[model samples]
Target chain A: MNIFARIGYAVMTVLAQLGRLALFTGKALAAIVSPPIYFRLILTQMMRIGYFSLPVVGLTAFFMGGVLALQIYLGGNRFGAEAIVPQVVVLGITRELGPVIAGLMIAGRVAAAIAAEIGTMKVTEQIDALTTLATNPIKYLVAPRIVAAVISMPILTLIGDSIGVLGGYIVSVYSLDFNGSAYLKNTADFLHSDDVTSGLIKAAVFGFIVALMGCYNGFHSKGGAQGVGNATTYAVVSSSILILAADYVLTALLFHK
Target chain B: MSTPKIQLIGVKKRFGSKVVLDGVDLTIEPSSSLVIIGGSGTGKSVTIKSILGIIRPDEGTILVDGEDITHINGAARDRVMRKFGMLFQGAALFDSLPVWENVAFGLIQGRGMNRAKARDIAIQKLAKVGLTEDVAFLSPSELSGGMQKRVGLARAIAADPEIIFFDEPTTGLDPIMADIINDLIVSTVKDVGATALSITHDMTSARKISDKIAMLYGGKIIWQGPTAAIDSSGNPYVDQFIHGKAEGPIKMAVKA
Candidate 1:
């Protein structure tokens, strides 16, 4: 094929994929609001996507906050503003790092899992089986995950923000020889409720993206095991990229003023 | 004559450049077993899926009980789908759910039956398929291929559907086990008075279970007759497929 033809083909493929993803998102959202909501399934998914994700999100947030504090201390020392460590860490964690890091981590963990599970179900005809049994696959499978993820992510981000701030406090008090009480006071003074809420809003959007990508890839998966494996990879890659891209867009929208 | 239980008129489907079903038409009478025999990629499954509304035909009309069901959605689609119970080629049991739940899935999820009531009916259906009560609580993964097929059969009959579709019901079973399943399918389908539509490349299973058989080749139903008349189909493709002949007009697409 010529270069022009190849470029055209690529554009068409990307457009087709985008259309499919949009359609899937619309259907999943519709299923979420419709009747016969599977509260049991949603609760089960919350335990899996939110409660179980606490450890990884907590650990990553703690280390990230500690590192951020150390870097800010070094940078601030040069400007004779060493006391800015608590303020900067709190602002960063509550506004950006906490939600973005938690979203990316869950994208890797939960998104990959949902894709592989649903993709396997597709290959094995279990999805078709659901259809045969008079159950809509979208309502039965996709909606629960999307609903649970949307509800779970903000809560996970909130917990992660707390842990991250505590990590910064630990580092400021011990490693940097700062006063613990003063550091807490500075963090509390600098952090606004708006900052925390904005991060949570971003978290909810990221959650939807992660679950949507997973379901879209998995539902379209064909062939066999190899196809399912590819879906899992695509789910993680697309969701992680989308999470980052959405973070930029959301950050601009939420914190622009 | 009375209207047939299921009808497909000029059903056509294509995946990319390859045409899977090319203007295929067939009619199935009520409470009769009809098996579609074909090669591996001969659109046998596609034909069944089209009728079941799993894969909509690009161009066609599918009718169930004289009602045009070619385009319906939501609750109407669910109501149409409730008439069907399918036994997938690989059983397709939910690995997460135990055998009894797999059987009761439709009753509880689709019809909103109480769980305890659905479980009782599930056990009863399992027994009808020669499966004991002990197997009900076991996960589908714990069962062998034959046992899984039995569970799938039980699930198909659980709701006492008006129409039952068996997609390669005995694809991977030993001859004895396959024959047993064939017998179970025939008897269970008879017991429920369901109109059975099965697709299989397994000629033995087809011959054993079906009262009438249709041959699908090159994306069309080339020949259809009663099971006893299949030997005299006179069509080369049907002859080649039924007798398992390699040297015939229907050449196997073996890549060099």
Candidate 2:
């Protein structure tokens, strides 16, 4: 009976958390449409969330693409189907690796950063100070971040996709001794626009998840430094999980015949 | 008589199982300073937060300028908030912004003033707070605690608000700095002619800045009177607190 009670308590707690998150998301969405849109803040957030993230996202995409090409060549060689490397690499890079990898990397880098920054602001009563100053915290803080993430994620993912395909091309031509022009032709011919667009759509959703989780954890943070630390960790962990979950759902929706 | 600039009637707030404010009723006359004093964790901050609409009271009403603003939100709340400024316990300056930008935040964001004019006013306000124009360009993190408090004070008065709240303004300062802040509080409130509400455990600050003083204990204002009359309030709790007595009706919740 005690075990059952504990299980029930845990379930209830999880539900309560979900309810709170839903409300926070709704308020953030509403704030986006409200007056005083804070275009400057949104642009600043874009530079922080998107522009600063390029190096990390680009490097990760490059490595992932190279590794994927090598593995696909090696595995296809075993099956006597090594010639499928170009088609598979482009398809894999565009449809899955680019968005998912970029999203998870940002969940670590950007989400944690957002949480820590806002959590410190909250703990120090800067959030309350904003309130006293007649500034809507959601409008001033959360909306800008969410808008920036949504706008920037797809752009980042597009760059990541191009870099990732380039990585695969480099590895296949230089290391695997494949004809570089033939590889490029195969990748371009086999890859439909839908594959790239699907990944981009996923990237945008992942961005929303990352920023929302970060801001939500931050706004709710309590105590002081330890609480902000916990918020940073929670923001990364939750957003990473949500990003992958979202990726799966997006993939199924975008690619299912 | 003119309506009290701020009033709290039976304001009650609780956090989970902990009741922080049971039934707090208080009033501040226009252009006068009132300070609420209490031990740490006795709801002094909560009282101010409730009045500021940062914390919602579970029961009762809060009136600002005689308008019942207990549950007003969105634009109405923003409009009400425009009448107020607050210096948080930690000064709470935006580290992302330089001192001048921090001071000018309310003017730029809330009032939609242009940057050049706002920067000019920010510098003036900083000078009023004894901060030089060079300090205005430095980030808040670069300032000392006392300077941060001064910058916060500058920000509070930048828009010439109707009311200003000081929360533990001198908590982390040395004695001389605390006295300086208290003096600044008195001078600045006079300068703006703004009604002032402050919460602090610092009795000297309360005595120096407030015309009226209220002592809060166990979530209630147990004693209140003119600053001069505080010595003769005859309330044992106020007597205990003012004298810094450990053995009295007001007991500390210290445990071994």
Candidate 3:
């Protein structure tokens, strides 16, 4: 084939692959309409993908909140307006830093794990075995992860948001020598409902993206050990990249003010 | 004569310019084992996958018990699949689940049986594969390779499926364990009276478990006959693959 033809063929091949993936996603959604909801399986996935993700998300959020408080204090001090530190720290964590950090951490933890688990299953033919047993794999496997991620991420983000604000609160009360009531009041006054709502919304989207990327890379992984390893790496890297890009887009839309 | 349990006519599958299956036809009888033997990349796995609807053929009609089931979708396709049990080559047991939960996966998840009931059946199936009740609670990662294969066998038979597919079941195991697995395959298939389709390069597994042996080459089943007659099949491809000869009609892509 000519070079032009080869390029065209490559593009077409990519499109065709996308079409196949779209078809798989549709089949998974269709299976969701069937009976045998597998509620127990969903709950089990929720525990694994969501509930278990707390400690990592909490630690990351706490540290981030403290760091944000310190940075804002330093930057505001340069302007002789260090009092803005509390407002800036609370607003930054609730609006951007909190959900994005929590989402990225969960993505690193959950997405890579899900991808590796499911990818290994794919290569070994466990997914095929499920099909042979009359179990729709999308419902039995992918759907639960997706649902759990969407549901659990918001809750996890809220907790992270609270802990992160508290981290900022601790930093401000002790190091910045701000009165506790004033710090709390400044935080309360400066942070809007939209800021928190936007973060939670971003968390849900990030969770969806993370789970989808992980499951997608995993479900389609070929070869043996090398294929699964590649899938796990792809899941983490892709999820982190997508999380950051999405944060920018969402911030622009949700907080144009 | 019994009706064919599974039949594929003029099946074809191609990946881009490369063809994986070229006009393949196969018929599997009920309550018997048919093992497809081929060197790697000859499409034995692809054939089984096509039968299971894991990979759709470009042109073919796959009939299960005289039903043209090539294009059915959603709930109907799943209903057709309920009759099958598969013991994958690698034993594909879920690492996240305990051994019993893996075996009873279909029983509870697919059939909506309560956990208590599924656990009972799970333990029973595990026992039949030479495992005790204590082994049921361990993760699949904790088991030895041989034990893993047996657990795979247990899971395959757990639902009492009418059909079973084994894809390279003996790959990556010691010869002794391979023989053990071969024995287990024969006895279990006989016990359940389930129709079996297996793909293997291992001549020992092919010889031990197959009542009928089919050789796949160039994307077609070039020779098929009784297992006892594979020695004198008279086909160069079959002879070469069976004996593991380096120089034969079936050439490998050897690099310098």
Give lDDT tens digits, candidate 2, residues A3-111.
9999999999999999999999999999999888999999999999999999999999999889999999999999799999989988998889999999998999999
Which candidate's DockQ is highest? 1
Cα lDDT tens digits, model 1, A91-186, are 999899999999999999999999999999999999999999999999999999999999999999999999999999999899999999999998
Tens-place lDDT per residue, model 3, A98-117, is: 88988889888999999998
Our model 2 lands, by Cα RMSD against the true structure, at 1.3
Give model 3's DockQ, 2 decimals: 0.76
For model 2 the local lDDT of residue A238 reads: 99
Q: What DockQ, between 0 and 1, does each candidate earn?
A: 0.94, 0.93, 0.76
The TM-scores, one per candidate, come to 0.98, 0.98, 0.91
Q: Each model's fnat? A: 0.95, 0.93, 0.90
lDDT of 2 at A198: 92
Query: What are the per-residue Cα lDDT tens digits for candidate 1 across B139-218?
Result: 99999999999999999989999999999999989999999999999999999999999999999999999999999988
TM-scores (chain A) of the candidates:
0.98, 0.98, 0.92
Residue A56 lDDT, candidate 3, scale 0-100: 92
Model 2 per-residue lDDT at B29: 98
Off by over 4 Å in 1: none
- Put down candidate 2 lDDT per residue, B25-137, tens digits, no spaces: 99999999999999988998889898888999999999999999999999999999999999989999999999999999999999999999999999999999888999999
TM-score preference between candidates 1 and 3, better one: 1
- Native-structure RMSD, model 1: 1.2
